[model samples]
Target: MNAESPNIGAPQRPVIRQLSEDAANRIAAGEVVERPASAVKELVENALDAGAQRVDVTYADGGKTLIRVADDGCGMTAADLPLALSRHATSKIDGSDLLNIHSFGFRGEALPSLGAVGRLVISSRAEGFEGAQIAVTGGAIAAVRPAALNRGTVVELRDLFHATPARLKFLRTDRAEAQAIADVMRRLAMAAPYVSFTLRDVSGGEAREIFRTDAEQGELFGALAGRLARVLGRDFADNALPIDAEREGLHLTGFAALPTYSRGAAIEQFLFVNTRPVRDKLLIGALRAAYMDVLSRDRHPAAVLYLACAPELVDVNVHPAKAEVRFRDPALARGLIVSALRHALAGAGHRASTTVAGETLGAMRPEGPRVYQMDRPSGGAIRSAYAWQAPIFAEAPAPFAAAPEPAPEAVNYPLGAARAQLHENWIVAQTADGMVIVDQHAAHERLVYERLKRQMAESGVAAQALLIPEIVELSPADAAR
Candidate 1:
């Protein structure tokens, strides 16, 4: 050993001792409860896993001082309260098979981890059982006692990260964290369209509703559409195309937006694996690949896609928070998404998204002030002026008097008939509801490109044999390269 070594006289043998249960739980909290949003995600997911029909979440000061989640879900019994706060205790799965997980939680770490870091209270009343409540502060459990409740469970967590104040330093601003919480709720709501969700913010003794969606009714797609309309807005619901496709054992279902309705950032893309929301790179890559041709590189396609398969085919235990998964056949899943979205987009044909018309109308709105119907000429006065011009129309030249070419018969076509051209580039067409202004060069380029692609698809690649075959012999090692 060097004489100047810092550990020259230190003990040769190290002593190892088991960490206290409370200390161990705090360590686990470091992994499970990173921020307010993470805590919200775990609690909400637990509620959903417990067969919740409706979930209500409220937070204060970005969940630093207060956070509460009440769910109309199957409640736990008094005997289960203490166990639920123990490490590695969960009702979501058996210890036998990890690959076949169907719920959002399995490791049984979220509740205990949360209790270790916050002042946690769970009150509940199960069917055929009396109401009970349990409280834990900084990993110190209190005796279970009778409490008042209704049909489900209410979990209240106050002063989160109170035990480990160091973790609080990593939190973002209150507004940003609240937005993150809302984002989590939105993803879960989208995942389970049939379940209702309400999120509220309670700060400074005032309760403000942030987001709410009632349970949707009807078939899967219909319910999903209604839920989407409520959650993602009517614009998305109207512009999105329905996607239903299957390959091998995987079934893909969701709505994908039209290329014309794409966004500048990848904000609205939501992917789920067997009803569990996931942020997987493989699925995102597949979505981008599907729309690579229709959308520019700077634009991102918006979609909400769900991939369903046998539970055993995908492993959901890949991450601590269950945000990622491992697919038994990643290629198969990727190919299914890519093919389904591409097929849907291809089948949309020449249809323009409603967002385009909305944007056009918005842009055409006048900025000037004060114009009312009463300020304009009366309808009878306009009719009388038209009657005065009738004889002038009758005295017009023969070319002008030939019924004006029947107004170009604007009937079936959405673009109606090409009425005029301007600057040798813009083509103006009349439609039933309104007029369409198109860039002639851009439209022509797109039409030509589509035609070329169609021809290529029809004729296949022209194949011809090489005039002369030139080959070189290689050694065994070089041939492998």
Candidate 2:
């Protein structure tokens, strides 16, 4: 037994081994650099951390061929260029404090992660210093050298994931990836209205500017509305209600749309913490709850909310990509959003959006001459030519009529008194200023839907078993609230 199998009971040698720097960085890149949009996010965040006032992004072939991000921030010198490419070399924070993170690119993982999977070239120039450049390819470091540049930094990455073809295979179509990149740019632009941003497409032989925003730093929310109008469209501004509310040291400020202006999807909702864009579950749920009463169940309200609080109140290092966040007091943040949004909406009143109002006016103008009717109470009133005389008969005492009912004060009411039901469904209501045309069918449908929802909420939904047993599966980890 000893000669043939080398003794089965013999202890095996330790198989543990340390990974090379390249392999370690590549592994980290898989998490940090998921796609081209991720690369754009990390690089732009680094630029912003450098105090860049203007950032420019150019991409080709959906960033699979080439991607460039240039910023006019304080750049690095020849001595610092090489260190900037080194792993864990960060200027944002020291090793002491993890909770106090003001800048976006705190962890030194993004740069190395990018260099590990792509051909990266960083050219930078510090103030009153010579310009320099450094290159990294597939995690292989190159020597720092002098480069031709006046000021700031420009980072270019070509042939992303070329060394790792499998990563390239997982990328989406060029159009989809390009749209994702645009979304990232727009979100960042909205967050930093003071800083200018430009995006270019250099795919079809020549470079063309896709989107651009100039630096317009002013008072808080200054030019923010203009920027939002440009990004979300002019109609959004016409329909949006300004929100400025604070509670429990958390200040919330942004634009929330009217309930009637709700969209078919929740894509327009944007949430930020201390000017940092995020998509957290607590924030999203609170937004939904705020619009629960005003908006229909099938529709979604659009808004862009920014919250400013102490850095310690929020943990931005929840993930390597830094897209999600963990609030120290999650309940405080949720309550702040719900309270702020509801207050803003209440102040906005029960009015429709500009688009809806215009459409209603246009539709009514095409109809025939407007007909007027007598205002009568709905006390078992029948639709007859003697409809006007029935009210007098109801108040009669003996042979003559008793005291007639006092007329209602129409000025205090919103829709005034209902006059008649024209065309069977349309209710002609007289107002102090003008008459309001209400579609009874549509109004009744919404009322019924809301009533059903209230009943379900109070009693809970009843479940009925199917004739055949059904199968369902759930993940081990709990879903977001």
Candidate 3:
């Protein structure tokens, strides 16, 4: 040891311990559920997975203030209530099985995350047992207690992000949050048409009948169409065309609008896989390819398409939110959408009518008119007519009265002429420098959606002008959020 400076040991380092259950839950929640809408999504999925026939969601102050989701699903027993809020405790999946996920949620993170961040109260009752309630606030759990409730689950969340005030600043206005909540409800409702869904805005006193479907419906399409009519308005149902086709073990089914009914944006394209709503690029590309020939570059079509196949063919776990997916065979999925919609449209007998001078013309006629006639000149025919015509009309004799020439026919310029049908379904068009392989269905869908959006924006949405307005019923707690 030097006398000038006493021998000193290395600086002491603090040992790190594994996060506690409550801390771990808050961390997990940061990834799975962010805002109130995320909480709503997880709860709604849980309800659906629990075999709920009807679900009701209510919100206030853009979900920053409050959110509640009640489901008439298989209610939880008293024993299950405590386990429901425990981290990593989920009825959806087993820890051994991470590869195959059939349900919308399986991480077992939602309940814990929600409880960690907000004032969470979960009340439920199975058929045999009395109702039980559990409350958790800021990662602190209160003991479970007996409660009175119907045979269902009601989850109430209040003061979202109160424990984490930093997240509170990220929320939007109440109206915007309400709109986002409505959008989520619409997507979920579209996915599960057989389930009744109701959404209420407690802050504004605005109640929307989001969805109502009879479980006895023969097939999903009918119920889905009814639900879409409720969310997207009845005009969409009338304008949409049915789509059903199969390729490479994948089945595509849904409805797409005609090119004439396009919208100004791609917002109307509702895509689902195995009854789970998603926004896959391949599917959107395929839809675009379907209407490439009939629509302009600026427009999009309106469509609601469902794809079904083996779960292994598509990976739904690509995102935490699961709004997007990855396909084992991207080309095959794109091809299926393009071919299905193209074939369906063709079979429906919808031919693009020619437009000229603001008027739609019927199909072309080979012998309709002779704009230029070619004939062998008779004896003195050409010379004599030309020789006499110039002298008689020296100053053009006041322009000749002739019908205006018909406007040029609009031609289908294959995007790049690199038009190759991939997988016997998709039409790949080459661009000027880059290649633009389109999904015929998604392209047409974009076009149709664009036109409709433009028309709506200019003249306001064409409401059905209801003879008798449909009245919506709501629950008291739901009404109060």
- lDDT, candidate 1, 202-303, per-residue tens: 988999888888999999999999888887877788889999999889999999998877888998999999999999999999999999998889989999
lDDT of 3 at 203: 69
Per-residue lDDT of 71-101 in model 3, one digit per residue for the tens? 9888998789778888778887786756577
Q: Ten-residue segment with the worst summed lDDT in candidate 3?
A: 356-365
Q: Which residue pairs come into collision in candidate 2?
A: none
Report the C-alpha displacement of residue 336, candidate 3, in angstroms: 0.9
**Candidates' TM-scores?**
0.78, 0.76, 0.70
Minimum summed lDDT over a 10-residue window in model 2 is located at: 472-481
Each prediction's Cα lDDT score? 0.85, 0.82, 0.76
Give the per-residue lDDT of model 2 (tens digit) for 268-379.
8999898889988889999999999977888999999999999888899988888799988899889988988888877766566765554443433324565556555455
Off by over 4 Å in 1: 1-3, 6-11, 358-481
Instruction: Rank candidates, lDDT, best first.
Output: 1, 2, 3
